[model samples]
Target: MLLLVHAALTFMLVGLILMVQWVHYPLFAQVGAATWPAYEREHQNRITFLVGPLMLAELLSAAWLTLHPPPALPSWSVWLGLVLTLLIWVSTALVQSPLHGRLSAAFDARLHRQLVVGNWFRTLVWLLRGGLCLWWLTLLL
Candidate 1:
């Protein structure tokens, strides 16, 4: 049950990260410069509403699963998932949050590009985590 919930949350997050990477972040440059700050602020606010709880659930569930994995699931795999989740959080805090802060003040072309590029770390991590979940599911079946 815990594994299923964790896998589902990770899968959902994977989908969202992909969309943000390819669709949303790339479009930041299209927002008019005069209003970019406000747009960036609103974007952050709305995305926080959408992602905050899901991220919390993913983090908590992943941590719990690491400590109390199902009998069939290997401890190493759970630990890897937890590590990946931790990497995502660290990347968000260290890399993405600062970029968002700068953008929230004013849009800079280089920073926007960096934001798009830096986000690939998250996108790739989530993709790997999602694949790990699928592998775990197969093991269960």
Candidate 2:
């Protein structure tokens, strides 16, 4: 039951993360030309209103797994999962959040560069997550 719950939550978090990266981030990035200010305003709201709590839920789910631990799951896999989670957190703080903060101020060439560079973080994070998901499935099956 606990495993099922953890699996479900992890899947949910993955879906949300994918949407934010593929949909929200692209939209936010492109909006710089036509409706930069409006996009920036609403983007901030969306992050606060939507992504913030989802991220928290993901962290909480990870924490639950950590505390209880999963049976039959390798210790190395768990450590990798934990490190991936930390990488996401650190990437958000060091890359994404700072870009958003700058976006809130001014839209410029630098912002474009930042967004492009920052996106690598998102991409790498997603790739790591997908790898983790595969490993997770391997554990399950």
Count backbone overlaps in model 2.
0
TM-score of 2: 0.77
The lDDT values for all models are 0.95, 0.68
Residue 140 Cα positional deviation in candidate 2, in Å, after optimal superposition: 2.8
lDDT of model 1, residue 53: 95
lDDT of 1 by residue, 97-130 (tens): 8999988988899999999999999999999999
**Against the true structure, whose lDDT is highest?**
1
What is the C-alpha local distance difference test score of candidate 1? Answer: 0.95
For 1-141, candidate 2 gives per-residue lDDT tens digits of 555654555566667667766676665555656678677777778767866776666667666666766777776766666677778888888877777777776667677576765766756665676667567767888
Error of 1 at 53 (Å): 0.7
Model 2 residue 27 lDDT?
Answer: 59
